[model samples]
Target: MRTAYCVDTVRAAERDLMARLPEGALMQRAAAGLAAACADLVGRVYGRRVVLLVGSGDNGGDALYAGARLARRGAGVTAVQLAPGRTHAGGLAALRRAGGRTVAPEDAAGPIRRADLVLDGIVGIGGRGGLREDAARLAALADGSRAAVVAVDLPSGVEADTGEVRGAAVRADLTVTFGTHKPGLLVDPAREYAGSVRLVDIGLDLPGEPDLEALQHADVTRLLPVPGAESDKYRRGVVGIAAGSARYPGAAVLAVAGALRGGAGAVRYVGPAGHAVLARYPETLVSDQGPERAGRVQAWVVGPGAGDDAGTVAQVLASDVPVLIDADGLRLADVGAVRGRTAPTLMTPHAGEAAALLGVSREEVEAGRLAAVRELAGRYGAAVLLKGATTVVAGAGGGGVVRVNPTGTAWLATAGSGDVLSGLSGSLLAAGLSAVDAGSVGAYLHGLAGRFAAVGAPVGAHEVAEAVAGAWRDVVRG
Candidate 1:
């Protein structure tokens, strides 16, 4: 897992390291990494024009020292000091010693435009809001220029802790962060501003659970449910699905389509469209009495095309198994009953449904996705997966870090795809994974499946479901 700790955690780690090592060692390490990355950007740093937008903090110090390295390597480096008097004295002297020149903010535009690379060092973790007037002006100038922008630590004006951009922020082509990853680099708003992120290890040795994590292929493989030699149909897991209706039998088929591929031992279907589900998947055990009467299951996937049947929803919630609520289930849910359930509940809400549940506009939820997901988790006391271009899964109790699904594609937004995801996640939940892991792993598999099924073209929901085995195989292979 690629873990991201909050800014405060990063700071604490850095402070502990700083106390153990010699003074300014961490800063030197950060500068060396920054300079190396810049050198790679401009092949043969010799004679390349580099501009540093220096601010008043250590972030600016890092840029100044990096510019000094570039200057020593025969690059023509100019430091545009935004806060002349407040700039790091040692950094300025080092740059001057290394044959770097300084230019006033008023005289920076021409050089910034003509430069081959720009280093944005306007603000770091200490910054609260957007850039100051002078910093914002320089950022705007840099944005308009053709220079390849590299932000040190983070982009100027972005909230390092929350990934929230209060106002205008620098849009970096690459961000070279120090110590560990920050939340701003993973979540949206600020994440949109951060282009491709590169982490430079400064040996902070951070301990404890991360504030956020993005699962890589290896992490997903470990979390995935794989059958053992001694496993049987009942021993693996049984997923019960309460979905579909007489009006929309396809929903039932699609939900079962996903459930069958979920690594579950068996699937039990209970709904009005049991005949259609049975026709599609002969392995499914059908029942018309409802979810409670459908007998035992390791997990329950409720909603999909459940329509307005509150009785079925109530019965499903009554079960003491892990429950995944999606589609129509989200619409017909009794909030109090869902909260009062004994089993772990996971709600998968698209932006529209999330907005309705939160009593806000859809645009509001989309704009601040991190906040919205956390708010839902806190309110419902359940694991909440807010699906979109960027899927965020927030766990209950407000302690664990929210997970951001990075493997998402625009193609996965097709019809009935979510039903497949609900089944897949429900399967994982039944397989004994925690609700957060189940939701995140399900997204990972669904995205990989969509990509495999699409293959540069459109694909139907059944094809996506069929491709799950291949996706799982590929993940396991890696």
Candidate 2:
């Protein structure tokens, strides 16, 4: 699992490490790592023109010191100071001693255009909102250049804690973050700006649990349900899917498609679209009786083309089994009923659904997904899986580390894709995984499957469901 810490936590760690280390030692270590990464990106540092966007903080100091290292290697390094008077004294002295030159922000455009590389140290992680006008202009210049732009710690202008890009932000080809990964680097919006991330360990001893976690293949593999020699269909676990309406039968078929491959022993489906589901998956136990009479299932997946079936939604919520509410179910399910449930409940909602639940605009949810998901989870007293460019899963009561799914593709944004996810996650829930685990693991597999189904082109939701086994195999193989 990859973990990320909040800015405050990371700052505390850095301060602790700095107190124990010799003066300037910690910055030197960071500068060395930053310099090495810059060398690797540019291939040959010799004779290359490097431009450093120097601000008025330790981030700017890191860039200046790294620029000094490159200058010593025969590279022509120039520092473009955003705040020339307030720049790090020691870093500036080191760069000047190493044959590096400093230029004002007004004269930076020409050098930025001609430079082989640009390092953005315009703002540190602690800086809020967007870049100031001077820094924003330099960021714009760097964006228009042919050079490989590398951000120091994080891309300037993105909130390190929330992953929100409120205003102008630098778009880096790579970001060299020190000590630990910031929450912004792992989530979306900010993640999109931070093209590729490279972590540089400066040896800071961070405290407590991370703010966010991203599951790797090994993490998902361990959480996945594997059958034993004595395992049978019922023993493996049964998933009940109460989905689909007379108008949209494909949702039922798609949900069942995902459920069958989700390591479930048997699938019990109840809804108006039972005939459509049985026609596609003959093995499915179909029933017209409500979820109450759906015959003993370990877990239930409600919603997903369910329309306004509030009665069925309430019935599923009243069950003792772990329940996953998605699509239309998210809208129909009562908040009071959900909060009162003793069993685990996972609510899967896209930005829009989440906004509706929170009584806010969709734009608010999209801009600040981390906050939105956490708020929804706490408000409903359930685990939440907010589906988008970066899928995040937060546990019940909204207090632990939020799990970010790092494996999705834009191609997975098809019509019935979320329905497939609902079934797969519901099966995992039945297989005895917690709401957070089930949601995160299901998202990981679903995303990997989506990648497999759509290599580079568009794919249907059914194709994505079909690729789950391949994704599972790949995870186990690793």
Best by lDDT: 2
Supply every candidate's count of residue pairs whose N, Cα or C atoms clash at under 3 angstroms: 0, 0
RMSD of candidates 1 onward, in order:
2.0, 0.6
Task: Please report, in order, the local distance difference test score of every candidate based on alpha carbons.
Answer: 0.89, 0.95
lDDT of 1 by residue, 1-478 (tens): 7888888788889999999999988899999999999998888898899999999999999999999999999999999999999998888999999999999999999999999999998898767788888888989999999999999989998988788788778999999999888888888878888898889999998989988899989999888888899999888899999999888788889988888888889999999898888878998999988887888999999999888888888888888999999999988888888889878999999999999999999988987888889999888888999998878899974457889888756788898999999998998888888899999999898889999999888888888999999999998999
Native-referenced Cα lDDT, model 1: 0.89
Give the lowest summed-lDDT range of ten residues in model 2: 127-136
Q: List pairs with backbone clashes in candidate 2.
A: none
Regions of candidate 1 where Cα sits further than 4 Å from its true position: 455-460
How many Å off is the CA of 11 in candidate 2?
1.0
- Error of model 2, residue 92, in angstroms: 0.6
Off by over 4 Å in 2: none
